[model samples]
Target: MKMKSRFDRNFDIINYTLLGILLFIVMYPLYFVIIASISDPNMVNAGKTLLWPRGITFEGYAKILEYKEIMVGYKNSIIYTFVGTIINLVVLIPASFALSRKELVGRKLFSALCLIAMYFSGGVVPLYLLIKNLGMFDTIWALVLPGAFSIYNMIICRSFFVGNVSEDLYESVKIDGGGYMRFFFSIVLPLSKAIIAVMCLYHALGHWNGYLSVLYYMRDPDKYNLQLILKNLTESISTKTLASEGMSTDYLADMQKLNEMVKFSTILIAALPMIILYPFVQKYFVTGVMIGSVKG
Candidate 1:
């Protein structure tokens, strides 16, 4: 074993100190949000809910639960995200794998078209018109179908296939009298777990957080996803809390605290799924992204 010199020891100390500081800087906001969500909003606003929660309460969660639309929105969002991610994976994985093959006819042309579409698109007006013509406007299909697969993600998955999957394997499968379909289903997918995990995470996050499509195409309130619903609910809560006149000062103060608490709670609600999801796929994330990005 090599013994570290004084310079090496000093360097190690400095490096760990910097890393600890950086970790604190990155993590503090999330911690604060968590503490603030459960703490008395008055204490939070008064700058006293820094390291730990004070006057912890579940009232903010209770307030959110009182609204029935929030539950409906949660269900809708879950359905959209689940269905949309499945569509994305089904389209993206096969397309990416096909594109990674050199033997595919019109590969260059297809790749060129994808790149063009990724960089340029007919603006919102044309898309809206197309959706209307297809009779998909204000429909569930409107939320999940239009942007089912992302070209950029496809490129990444394709790169991953090219980099990680050996061409010799395909040749061996062909030698065994197995065709492309057999090779793809039985071989490619099982071996491409890292890239698949990465793509799933990416697409799931996109669908979960997405609201612009809902905002543009959805008109029926019941069909609204969680993001839009939460946004509107927050606004409605804020308006009712502040705009009501002739309420007692004590009542107003309580409403104000509830308003602040509601804000933090809603944020946590919106973000909780993604936060829970990331840890499960984290082991694959770095490997997939780095290898896919560096190769092809």
Candidate 2:
């Protein structure tokens, strides 16, 4: 390749400088949280810790880990995210694939129904009553089943199938003595990894971040997901700080600082899974989003 002119190099330098600043702006809050979680809560509360950790200590994390509900909450959250995402795909992918087929009878009608339902929902009270009547209340099914197949994801998957998957290949599969099942399992699905990854990320993030559904349907603390448990724990910080047994000024100040520090610790713990998961599927995620959005 020919070497760039001086103007091109100058423009490239300016672009990279702006991008670096933008990257830091987006990432600094996360970096601060990681450092703050391990730093002395008192120093954080005093605004003495900036750009670096101050009076580093692991006390906040140790306390959080020792809490009995923390592990249980983690277990439940993991189960919900994994199992829920699987079921969501099982329902969503097939429906989308079927709707994507121009040869299918009544496809348009079904697609219209999906679009209509996507735009409307029954009120929350009715939904709650239905869940209770079905005996899914306080159960894993309650969390996983309701809203399992999102019409939005279904539409994206259908678009991927229509725009990316070749109609001629599908017809050729039929000529080779294959049916819908064979084509889906052997051909279409194998070619649809990008969309699948995007759907999985969406559904997993929904389940992982879910707390309102748990609060509404499940009254038992033992059944609570991680988000709900951590939300409760974080809310209790004020109460605990105020209820500190010591009357000394130093003791009260320390309690306040510790509570603030623990907030960052809890957030870090809750977000760590998605942060780890994103990198593996990021390429497919970008491809799927672009194809599903900008393509037919």
Which lDDT tens digits does candidate 2 get at residues 74-164? 9999998889999999999998999999989999899899989888889899999999999998899999998898998888888888887
lDDT of 1 at 197: 77
lDDT of 1 by residue, 1-296 (tens): 99999999999999999999999999999999999999988889899999999999989889988878888889999998899999999999999999999889999999999999999999999999999899997788998888987898888888888877898999999999999999999999999887887888888788889899999999999989999998897888878986877999999887887789889888888889878877887876777669666854
| Per-model TM-score on C-alpha atoms | 0.92, 0.91
- The RMSD (Cα, Å) of candidate 2 is 2.4
Which pairs clash (backbone N, Cα, C closer than 3 Å) in model 1?
A: none
Query: Which residue ranges in model 2 land beyond 4 Å of their true spot?
Result: 1-14, 242-254
The lDDT per prediction is 0.88, 0.87
